[model samples]
Target chain A: AQSVTQPDIHITVSEGASLELRCNYSYGATPYLFWYVQSPGQGLQLLLKYFSGDTLVQGIKGFEAEFKRSQSSFNLRKPSVHWSDAAEYFCAGVRGTSYGKLTFGQGTILTVHP
Target chain B: DAGITQSPRHKVTETGTPVTLRCHQTENHRYMYWYRQDPGHGLRLIHYSYGVKDTDKGEVSDGYSVSRSKTEDFLLTLESATSSQTSVYFCAISESGQNSGYTFGSGTRLTVV
Candidate 1:
């Protein structure tokens, strides 16, 4: 079955510390990947996406994700975390052979500690 | 943010009642989608419309229905609401197919009591 998995259900880090959220996918081949952030009581906002080309993709709010084909991982990373970044993070992917529908992983809830 | 809008930012209805959620877009996108967000399950696609009248079922489309009669509006109807249908609903739009990306609306929080 094709699916995306986020191993960490919840993560906590100091406000100024580094942050990394893991995402792995099960697919026949390379798939289109994306990272989205959802603030409380708000809709999701696209943090970044990886279609093709470079592995390291930059997105808004100083967030970046690297797509590693060997590991089947597309982990989201931030050099320094902010308190405002505390929210639910989801990783989604689309199979190359399918339509525009998406398969999303169980989201990771980030908590920023002071 | 301003391109897509969802009606009744929040709604509560009794079980077995008919409920309808509306998604309106001004971007003139060709594809529209409805998804339900639940705890521990992320977001599941309920239904999607490729064109005005073209619609298809998604992974969890068992108890939901959708209609797209015009280019800018998509409606999701719950013929008979159930307790399991209480979830946050989000509507997204794409300029074209092939999963280029999606722009989502603010989302509607629906509760069935």
Candidate 2:
């Protein structure tokens, strides 16, 4: 069975500051990883996904993540965050055998201050 | 956007009653999924469909049943609504391969009293 862990439950950062959200997964094979963002009372939106390729993958809203196989981590980062970037972020992975089933992490709530 | 829409954006039902949530898509995607979002448990998949009339149980499908008679619509039914089932349900669609990411609907917030 595959699982995802997000170490931070909540993080607060000031506007224009760098932000990083940690995500770690346990999978036997090379995993298909994804990051999703959700605002309050809204459905999740895909931020980025990593199947196989460059370690650093860029996503919408100026967000990016690095897939580190050695550490089993795919951390989301933004050089400078805006207040509108405050939201809940989730990490998910798909089982290689399963067609489209995804296991998601607990989620990390980001609060951006001006 | 994948042109997915979930009906009854908000619903309040009583325990023991049956509730069905409808998900409609215009993108003609082959894969559709149902997921419930709770406070501490991000999102848990309840069911998914690969094609017309082809559906499978997800990680949390015990109290939920899904049907997909058409390629553009997937319905999720709660046999007996319970307080524990009160949460935001999201419908998502993906293109038919591992390379594509999913597009989610706004979500349906169901509250069971």
Candidate 3:
């Protein structure tokens, strides 16, 4: 079974500051990873997904993540954070015949301050 | 953006009552899923349907049941609502294959009293 772990429960960053949210996964083979963002009382919006190739994947809202197979981590990063970026972010993975059933992490709440 | 719709944006039901949540999709996705979200838990899958009349249990499928009569409609039922089932339920749709990430519905907030 594939599982995801997000070390940070909450992250606070100043506007225009670079931010990074760490995510680690445990899968037997190459995994399909994704990042999703959810605002207050809203559905999840996909940020980006990684299937294969291009370790560095860019996503919507100027966010990007790097897939490090050695460490089994795919960390989300943004060079400049906006106040509107405050939301809950989730990291999920599907691996080893997991058709579309995603194993999601506990989630990380992001707070952007000016 | 995947043309998914979840009915009853907010619902309040009494304990021991039966509640059904509907998920309708226009995207014609082959896979549909039901998940519940709580404070500490991110999203726990309740059930999933791969095709019409074909369903399977998820990690948290003890008190919940699901049915799919058509490709576009998936229904989730709580046989007897409980306080533990009071949470936000989200419906998601996805196509078959890799990298085709799941598209989520707005969610339905169900409160059991």
Candidate 4:
């Protein structure tokens, strides 16, 4: 079973500040990783995904994540934070033989302040 | 954005009553999944279907059942609704297993009292 861990339960960042949400996964082989964002009462929106190729992957809303095999981490980062970025972020992964089932982390709630 | 819709955006059902949640998709994705999101549990899969009649259980499949009669419709049934089943249920569609990621539905808030 592949499991994901999001070290931070809550993160607060000031407007225009750089942001990074950590994500760690435990799997036997390389896993397909994804980032999702959700507002208070809405469904999840895909941010980005990484399987192979370039280590750095860019996503919408000026978000990006780097896949580091050595550390088994795929962390989401943003150069500048916006007040509208306040939402809950989730890190998920899927193993090859697991079909389409996704394993998600506990999630990290982001709060942006001005 | 993948044309996925979960019926009864919000519902409150009494305990011991049977409730069914529907997930209809226009995207025609091959894979459909049912997940429940709790306060600290994130999203836990209940069941998933790979094809019209092929389905499999997920991690938390103890008290839930799912069926896919058509390619676009996946139904999740709570044989007998319980308070423990009260949570935000999400339906997600994936064209393929891993490469395409997934597009999620708006979700259905089910409350059992």
lDDT of 3 by residue, B1-113 (tens): 45999998999999999999999999889999999999868998899888999999999999999999999999999999999999999999998835677899999999999
* CA lDDT, candidate 3, residue B43: 94
Weakest ten-residue segment in model 3 chain A by summed lDDT: A94-103
Question: In model 3, which runs have C-alpha deviations exceeding 4 angstroms?
Answer: none
Give the i-RMS of model 4 in Å.
0.6
DockQ score of the complex predicted as candidate 3: 0.69
Residues A1-114, model 4: lDDT tens digits: 679999999999999999999999999999999999999998999999998999999999999999999999999999999999999999999998787799999999999999
Which candidate has the top score in lDDT?
4
Give the worst 10-residue stretch by lDDT in candidate 2 chain B: B94-103
* Worst 10 contiguous positions by lDDT, candidate 3 chain B: B94-103
Q: What does DockQ give for each predicted structure?
A: 0.70, 0.71, 0.69, 0.90
What is candidate 3's lDDT per residue for A85-104, written digit by digit as tens?
Answer: 99999999988476589888
| Candidate 1 all-Cα RMSD | 1.0
Model 2 lDDT on a 0 to 1 scale: 0.92
Please report the candidate that would top DockQ against the real structure: 4
Model 1: how far residue B64 lies from native, Å: 0.6
Candidate ranking (DockQ, best to worst): 4, 2, 1, 3
Clash pairs, model 4 backbone: none
lDDT by candidate, in order shown: 0.94, 0.92, 0.93, 0.95
Residue pairs in clash, model 1: none
When just chain B is superposed on the true chain B, each candidate scores a TM-score of 0.97, 0.97, 0.96, 0.97
Candidate 4: lDDT of A95? Answer: 93
For model 4, residues B3-110, the per-residue Cα lDDT tens digits are 999999999999999999999999888999999999888999999999999999998998789999999999999999999999999999999988887999999999
